[model samples]
Target: MRNVVLAHALARDLNVSAAVIAAFADAPNFHTAHRVRSSGSELLPGPGKPLITPLSYQSIIAMTQSLSRQASDWGDLAAWVNRKIEHVLLKPRHKLRNHI
Candidate 1:
């Protein structure tokens, strides 16, 4: 949705390919900081032909939930929460990976 909205806005402002806009729309998960930082990419213009930025969809939800609760807080259910949250957070990505 973020990607879609950005692509729509960029397409409205810039006369570029829909695919290019679509690609930019998915930068968080499709790219890495190393790739974006190693050098400028398709996001740059003028002589940069293959303007591509990688997306790396960092997961904050699980991390936040984990940090919100501590070992003492979990008491006897730490293991259960760990397994359950891990599964919930990873399920979509796992499916995506499998599908891909």
Candidate 2:
């Protein structure tokens, strides 16, 4: 496994025991383990954390597909402009409300 190879290389390079190298590799996990403090606050995830949102991912894919299918003609451009104007005008109140 990659961990074993890395531990071996680190052990050789740093002139430390394999157990020490393995401990070093696991230091982050050890520090970040989920345990409540006396003050009742939890530590937030740091670097190398991945979060997934399925609906957001699907919405982006759909938007890309829809935009790619729009025609390059002048009429299509005008319609697109009108739609943008309507969205900007009609949705300003809702957008500002959401932000506030």
Candidate 3:
């Protein structure tokens, strides 16, 4: 969802073709829904306590590599994505540190 929004922004800013932006926004078939499990014990956990499982470190690495490859295939879109990622990651921390 967020990726779609970013793709639109990139399309407008970079003058990317709509077809390419659509391709970039499409998720790879490997992507799947997060699994849900009981919050505590498997058998004795309280009701209404489902927890969404987080992606493993290896999964994160694989997804990052896949995205990198996809971005690279898009040429200039790759640079735009990297800049957006850096800005999103660093801007908040810098603002927080300044406030502190």
Candidate 4:
């Protein structure tokens, strides 16, 4: 179950396709799985609620979009930091060489 969730999250973050995510999660019937509801409520009544409900397609898509945005933001931040670091480290060397 945790693996399925992680696979889904990674798929979102990495921009992987639904088929790939499903394969990674070992859920061959991924498309139909979400539509399935627990039948326990019908048979056992009251206390037999499902512990884990399947994620809807809309929720999955929303999650993927959110993760993609976050990844893009992080990538932008990393690029900015790399440029700053390069400027700081290289500028001093250039200054020292000029003074030499």
Listing every candidate in turn, what is its Cα RMSD in Å to the true structure after a full C-alpha superposition? 10.1, 18.4, 15.2, 20.0
The list of candidate 4 runs beyond 4 A from truth reads 1-69, 94-100
Candidate 3 matches the true fold with a TM-score of 0.23
State residue 78's C-alpha deviation in candidate 4, in Å. 0.1
- Tens digits of per-residue lDDT for model 1, 1-100: 4664576578658977433421222222323333454654445433544334443222223334467755454443445544544554456665644422
lDDT of 3 by residue, 1-100 (tens): 4654565577669976322111211112212212212222122113543222244333444466677856444555545555544554455654633322
**TM-score for every candidate vs. truth?**
0.21, 0.21, 0.23, 0.25
Report the number of the highest-TM-score candidate. 4
Error (Å) of candidate 2 at residue 49 is 58
Which residue pairs clash in candidate 3?
none
lDDT by residue (51-84, candidate 4, tens digit) is 3444544445445557784666555654564554
Identify the runs in model 3 with alpha carbons over 4 angstroms from their true place. Answer: 1-73, 94-100
Among these predictions, the greatest lDDT belongs to: 1
What is the alpha-carbon lDDT for the whole of candidate 3? Answer: 0.38
- Where in model 2 is the C-alpha error above 4 Å? 1-72, 94-100
